[model samples]
Target: MSNHEDDVVSALKRGADGYLLKDMEPEDLLKALHQAAAGQMVLSETLTPILAASLRENRPSADRDIQQLTPRERDILKLIAQGLPNKLIARRLTITESTVKVHVKHLLKKMKLKSRVEAAVWVLQGKNG
Candidate 1:
């Protein structure tokens, strides 16, 4: 039940581990809670970019306008670059096979890539282009 962006930003900046609307499904909320308790921060996916943008605002050069990627997406891209299949990437990332497909879709869109091979090439090119 927190919508004040500044307050939300502050909590995140202070390293609060979990942020979710009260209306989230019980299963999803529990998952986030577990992740937080494990000392890993769990942010609402919608809030991720806000956090990224705020950090970028504070450190412009270091941020460099790079496409903000979820940790999963980054991991998938690395494996894709390494020529792994979706099933294998799923196993490595510890996510369901279907979730891996979703990550692949988002990665392709975010990276402006058309296929896994294109993504692999982009990574191989050191993400310069």
Candidate 2:
């Protein structure tokens, strides 16, 4: 709704459900609210193009790829992409939590990504191959 790149990016990164403008009709706002309550993501129609462009701009350059990850680091990256926290990843992988953290740190560095969120997005974008 604000159509500001920084605000849109920040809200999405922080897990905002929807970013509707205040200028929308009351009925539309109510519909968005109900859609959110029903567990759907509600982004304003106007935001899609900008949001897509922002995502593209933040990604690692073409030469920097996920292929640099070690085999174990790749496993951890996949788990991170699945939204599993370190503790759960450790449990699922039969490793220590600290070990998982170490792998995560390594994987993030190798992928040239900043956070688990970025890694997850990268994976979802089919960049993990």
Candidate 3:
């Protein structure tokens, strides 16, 4: 799997043979997919921190102002980290575009981020922190 987002991870856990990110250059993504189809583990440097950070403590920080998101929201957060468009997230989540917007708004508020890019960065950083 090669995507740097949760949807890809979910897909992988659900049995995807390959998972290239939308951000990857077409040539590289094609190469990675080819490698995956060849039975090789195709990965990228962007994935290193995520793999490393999956080991974080699970306890919630009561002192923080960040809202505790629902499991569904967390899933959305993962998609955001992948830099997916709201329409794409809606398609993946099987929700309406308006609903995805609401989730994005909620995520921005909960994470105290001013932009989706910031939230994406935070999600990546949180994984490795």
Candidate 4:
């Protein structure tokens, strides 16, 4: 039912496995449900291009802008890309959560990214290099 584009993007960023507009016909909705149950991502027709554009825009070029990151920052970025929460990342790195937050903030700024989800996509898609 949500028509807000930002809401749709945010939901996906937060790990929503499927997204469908409320206006979708019943048959399409059922098909989407089945697709979701089968471990496929489902998106409304209108949303597909939006998601694609977001991913394309967020993807980095081959210059390895990650070179701007320190070794530790790179490590934190990798964990963030893996979808680790700040607390868990801190525990894994033996650093304080606050410190992890600081690193995340710095890395996000350094990479010119708006959120951890973008960073995750970049890393997972091998765009960080």
Best by TM-score: 2
**Candidate 1 residues 1-129, lDDT tens each?**
675567666765454434687777899889978865644345566765565455445433332222577777888888877756677778888898799889988876765555554455456555422
List candidate 1 segments past 4 Å from native.
1-67
CA deviation > 4 Å runs, candidate 2 = 1-4, 8-52
Looking at candidate 2, the ten consecutive residues that score lowest on lDDT are: 36-45
Residue by residue across 17-101, what tens digits does model 2's lDDT show?
4578778889988997886675445667677666657768876458557678788888888877665667778888899989988
lDDT for each residue of candidate 3 in 26-84, tens digit (9 for 90 to 100): 89988877765644445555764553343233223232233477667788888877756
> What is candidate 4's TM-score against the reference?
0.61
Model 3 misplaced stretches (Cα beyond 4 Å): 1-67, 127-129
lDDT of 4 by residue, 17-128 (tens): 4578989999999998886675444668787566656777654455359999999899999887655677778889999989988998899788876566566656776677
lDDT of 4 at 32: 80
Candidate 4, RMSD to the unseen true structure: 7.1
* Candidate order (TM-score): 2, 4, 3, 1
Clashing pairs in 3: none
Using lDDT, give the best candidate's number. Answer: 4
**Total clashing pairs for each candidate:** 0, 0, 0, 0
Q: What C-alpha lDDT do the candidate models reach, one value each?
A: 0.63, 0.72, 0.60, 0.74
Write down the worst ten-residue block by lDDT for model 4.
55-64
